[model samples]
Every structure is written in C-alpha cells, then in structure tokens.
Target: MRKRARQESAFLNIPYDRRYESLYLAFIASLCAFGLRPRATIEIPSTKRRLERIIELIQGCRYSFHDLSRVQLDRNSPTTPRFNMPFELGLAVDWALGANPEHGWFVFESRAHRPEKSLSDLNGTDPHVHDGTAHGVLRGLTNALTRKIHDPNLAELDSIYRDLSKAARKIKESRDGSLFEARPFQDLAVLARQLAEERISSLRS
Candidate 1:
C-alpha cells in the first residue's frame, strides 16, 4: 500500500466552486486515465487544523496539481481575491523544497501568461495553460505528466469527462449538498478511477 500510494496518488489542488466544476471533473478523469489516483482535502478525514490536514494530505501523495486560474477577486461580498489555491501551492512548494524533494507539483492556468503576471516568483517556471476548457485541462495534464504507454488522447478524455459529468449530476441529485461536499467529492474520485480503469481495460482488450 505504501509503495502504491507513493507511485499513484496525486494531491489535487484546485478551486471548489460551480464555475470551476468542469475543470475539477476533468482533472479527476485525466489523472485517473493516466493511471493515477486523485486526493483532495474534502476526502481527507477531519483531524486538526485544516492547513495541517492539507499538508498531511500532500505528504501522502507523490505529486500535486495546482490550478491558479481563479486568483482574481471574488464577485461576492467583501470582494477579496481567492488565495486558497496559491496558498496550498505554497505548502506543496515548501514540502518539495525542504522535507520531500521528490514531491512533484505542477501549476496550471486558464490564460497563457497570467501565472507569470500573478506570481512573479515562478518566473523561471512555466505553468501549463488550459484556457479554462475541459480539453485544455486534459492537454495540460498530458504535457505535465508523460505516459509513453497507456497515453490518452483528447477524445478519450472527453468521453471520460462526459461520463463523470453525468455521474456528478446524479450524485448531486441524490445527495443533500454540492459536489464540493466531502461525500460527493469522494464519490466522484471513486467513480472516476473506476471509469478510467474500465476505459483503459477496453483499450487493452
């Protein structure tokens, strides 16, 4: 289990709102299609401070995917910029720099050059830009993580994403809350892995 966890699990650090729903599901599908498991704070059991829980979760995974597209100001009251994504990215960065140098973290954006403008610290680093589309997310993941064998194309990812979207709708309709809720999120991850596995199996057969 330890070896499998280190080899397959990936900490997903993305926005958890309706606007970012498509990309969220895309990330799950793409990661699973690439033969990886996706982990998030929602599925992490409650223990101590949320930040600590986040760090612990990151420690468990060998890779992390961060989407910094929603760094702009919030539209609702107070109108403050959302920093959770970047803040968590910082946690992953620190962990990669100090404790676990093997931890791999990838940054993604909706616009081409926005990441550079938003975070000057990452000047030398290139954040994969997905242009806020589901296909874009898949493309970014393909570029970020290579799989010489079992590699998936946009069509395969689109199929998995559509299936996940249908499943997400059913999950939300049957459940009492949003997709961001703990149970709902966990359900999506589980279903994604299953569907992705099925897809890969079919390809092999």
Candidate 2:
C-alpha cells in the first residue's frame, strides 16, 4: 500500500477541450482548497504514451475525480460520442477495486442519471451533478470531498474561489491575456498550493 500522505493526491479525469475550461479551473481550485494536490494527464510530457501516463498518475494518487459531463455526441461528428472520461473512470475503478480498495473516487455529471444512458453498468451509482457550470462544479466537488477529506466549510470554499479568481486574473494579465497555456497552468497550481497552505496555517494559528 502507498504511504498515507502520498494517497492525499487526487487524479482528475475530465474533458480537455476549451468548453470545459472553467469547470477544470474550478475543480483544481476546489481540490486545493480541500488540501489535496491535483494531478492530471496534462502534466505529462508528449514523449510518453498517453495511456501509460494516465495509469501512472492513477497509481500515484489515492483519490480520483472523474467527470462524465461531456459524453454526448460530438457537434461535428454526431454519430460518434466521446468516451475518454468514462474509459478513464473504468481504469481508476478497476485499479481501486483490485489493487487498493481503500482508494477513493467521486464521479460528476452535468445531469443526474445521464451516465446510465451511456453506461448502464453504473445504473445504481449516484453521481454528483454539476449542471455544466463552474459554480456547480465547485459545489459538487465540495460536497463529494467533504466526507472523505478535512475540507473547508462552504463559506471558506467560496473565499477560496474568490482568491483563485484573483490569482487567475493576475496570471492572465501577466501572460498577455493567454492564461490556459502550459506555464500559466503550472503557475496556477503553484498559487493554489500556496493559498491552501496559507489557509491551513491561518486555521491552525
């Protein structure tokens, strides 16, 4: 089994397209606020096989957040539906059940029971719905994690979001209005970690 501290890291599986950018940011910020390090495939370099990299991340992290909000048909390709999120969720679930039953996972969808249409196997499981909005993501994430982690209260979560928004705006200004690039994403993660540490310290003091 992995060390307890190492298990605090959370692997995030969500859509990578621009449409989910805000929800992505909210997820990152919410995880940091709960004092968890957020890990994603984005941090991996292009030199490695993507599947291998994702598996490596899942193995390293003790918890995972899987969002199946975009499993519908593609706008340009109506007949084809995206399955990356569900595919990753399956991987994580298998690893947790087989390797470490203690591993944790939270599934999020834009609509309740929608995942059942695409993945009937998950019929009875309740996925937190986020309504495809950033605030909804924040709320759902907070509720999902609070039971497992030492999470902040709802008001504190709101404060963390406010701080994240300010930090993101600063990063965007510094980057000449280009904020989602690799460097900016790294900076945002660093800022979130720092903010989380500060909050914890304040609570302790």
Candidate 3:
C-alpha cells in the first residue's frame, strides 16, 4: 500500500512563502489533476536530521517538481537568498542519476530564461516557465505530465485550481490564516486530491 502511494506521489519542491501561495496551491491542484499525490518536507518536523528526511521524502516520490521562481533575495535583515529549493532539487537529481532511475525530476521557473542564467547546471534542460501565474502553472503541468487513460484538460485543470484555491483559503483561515503551515498544507493537499478526482471524473462522464 505504501509502495503504491509512493508510486503515485510527486515531491513538491516549491517555496512556502506568502508570495508563492497562489503558485503553491496551483502546484498541488495541477499534480493532483493527473492523479499524482503531492508531498513536501512540511510534513516533517522541524527537528534534527531534516536534510535526511527531505532526501527520504524525495526517494518515496516517483516524480519531483522543483520550482525556482523565488529567485530574488528575501526581505530579511541580512537579505540572503534561499538555497533550500535548489539544494533539494540537487538531491532529486542525484536520486534520479545515481540512486533510482525510475525517479523523474522537473524544474520550473517564473521567467523563461532565468533558469539557464541563474542555474547554469541545468544548461541543456529546460524548466517549465510558469510566467508567475496560477494559469501558467496549470499549462506547465499539462506540458510536464500526461496520463494515457485520463489525460486532464487545461480548462478542467484551471477549474480545479480555482476550486482548490477557495478551499485552501478557508483551510488557512481556520488555521491562523497561514497557508504554508504543516497542518494546513496537509489539509490543502487532501482537498486538492479530492477536488481533482471530482473534476477528472466529470471529464470522463
């Protein structure tokens, strides 16, 4: 059962900040639209051995999506840039390259040419450019994944995303209005899976 779930899971590697909330929810909805469960490190406790836990999460998922849209420096006092997303992406790369050949990985960016300039390591690879919008994320996902039996329509995907956004907002409101927290994130994922199932079901009917 666990192995089956893992086969259906996708390690969601996106920034969990306020600025990326819409795109965050968009990713959850898009991945779920094609029947892939989205998992993240948020489920892990903020204790020791977090890095190892992240690697474990990546290993459990058959697919991994890395979003490098938060490319600018954060608004902290030190104003340092974030490396966690890219670092985990590296781990996913290592998993696909050396550890598990079945593990699939993808990169996403807001700007069309940013990943090539910012992360030259992915020179030959092309990151799905979302143009920093929820609609773009849906289109990007359509380009990224496909299901032979249940290929999702872009219009239906957008509908799912819109519905998920509404549910996510309510879930966050009940949880101190924080969209990126552990509990709310889990709720959001559950709701997204449900909503995607419904939307896709109607597509077949």
Ranking by TM-score: 3, 1, 2
TM-score of candidate 2 versus the correct structure, residues matched by position = 0.87
Which sequence of candidate numbers ranks them by lDDT, best first?
A: 3, 1, 2
Q: Which portions of model 1 miss their true places by more than 4 Å?
A: 45-47, 202-205
lDDT by residue (1-205, candidate 1, tens digit) is 8967877789999988888888999999888888778889887666758877888889889899999999888889989998989999999999999999989999999998887789999898899999999889988988898766668777878899999999998898888548887788778878887887777763333
Query: In model 2, where do residues sit more than 4 Å from their true spots?
Result: 1-5, 77-79, 147-149, 173-182, 202-205
Error of 2 at 182 (Å): 4.1
Q: Per-model C-alpha lDDT, please?
A: 0.86, 0.79, 0.87
What TM-scores do the predictions have? 0.92, 0.87, 0.94
Candidate 2 lDDT, tens digit per residue, 52-78? 999988888878999988876887945
Candidate 2: worst-modelled 10 consecutive residues by lDDT: 196-205
Candidate 3 local Cα displacement, residue 177, angstroms: 1.3
Candidate 2 has an lDDT of 0.79
Question: If both were scored by lDDT, which would come out higher, candidate 2 or candidate 3?
Answer: 3
